[model samples]
Target: MLWRRRAGMNGESDLAIHGATPGENIDESVRALACARHLPQPHLDRWLAMNERSRAAFLEIAQTLRLRTGQITAALELLEEISVRDATDCADILAAPEIARIRLHAGSAPARARELIETLRARRFPRLRETSTRLAGAIRELRLPRGISVVLPRELRSDVLTITVEVARVAELDGAIEALAARRAAIARIIEMLGGSE
Candidate 1:
């Protein structure tokens, strides 16, 4: 599972699993970030101390910059266009055939170009998602030697919870339960910090 940082309303951010079959490490990172966001100072410090890469990814997700309203509106329009077009149509649009004719009719607007690119990206997202899902499934189904486990760590403030699985091979069914357990633990800590419970 690849961890994807998605922009949220009001300049907030959230995490998403890029593939249908999620990875333990990706789940751990998502949980750790959510936990640290509400944890007290010392606990947060300890959480960051667990791993540098984890800290960086957390910060990057937390610090997502907001786009201007105009940019957002343009992006929305692009999304609409993407929704109506098939993959082949999208490719055709991007091929830049009859560039001179297009240039003559479209005029020279940077915003228009940006919008076109955005539309292309929006159209491609579903395809990307499908491909990622297939790859993740393949990875999950791979067989590995015994005694090796994939460790995923979820951190919150000064606490770190790790999910470890002992499996004979890297089959699709392996490690998911342990990873989900760790994720739940991390979420529980985060909720507690948010005044729910310990």
Candidate 2:
């Protein structure tokens, strides 16, 4: 289970499983108990203090929502594309409602994972994503040079932009740069399309 920090009854901080319904299995409970046995004194104290129902729920939540290594890695990579603050906020939000919703859905895990990421990305960076989409549309209208690509910052902290120009030879480099520069006004129009810079 991926550990989440939660406030304890005494106002101290500790790691606990966040989402548990009554849908736990005996096997999972046994595994959880085994794991609990190896925990340090303070953590073990908290675990042992839980009532049977609470302990059972904890075990169930831990088993059911445990993120696999691949899922964790993918989520980290996805979050890396955004601001650190947004990443932290997304993680805090994902710990509960999103995890529960995704778990209850009927679909391929990968598909659901993609959906979760896209949804979170949109939520966390609505304006930036919208700006990027509109910028792509505007750039498409220009029929950009094959050797050039436009890249926007995930979070638009400023109006600064990057246009990548790829060329095989020195002769084509100037042409590629010029072609991209020719579309500057069109690219600039994206702020208007997005209803002003966000």
Candidate with top TM-score is 2
Q: List the residue pairs that clash in candidate 2.
A: none
- lDDT tens per residue, model 2, 68-141: 44443344344444435554433344444555466456776666666665665675677678777777777678
Tens digits of per-residue lDDT, candidate 1, 75-163, equal 33443355356533222333233321222234445544444444445454755544434433433443323443432222222333232
Worst 10 residues of 1 by lDDT: 150-159
TM-score of decoy 2: 0.45
TM-scores of all candidate predictions against the true structure: 0.19, 0.45
| lDDT score, candidate 2 | 0.53
Clash pairs (backbone) in predicted model 1:
1-23, 43-157, 43-158, 44-157
Error of 2 at 174 (Å): 5.2
Model 2 residue 101 CA deviation (Å) reads 9.0
List the global CA lDDT of all models: 0.40, 0.53
Error of 1 at 15 (Å): 28
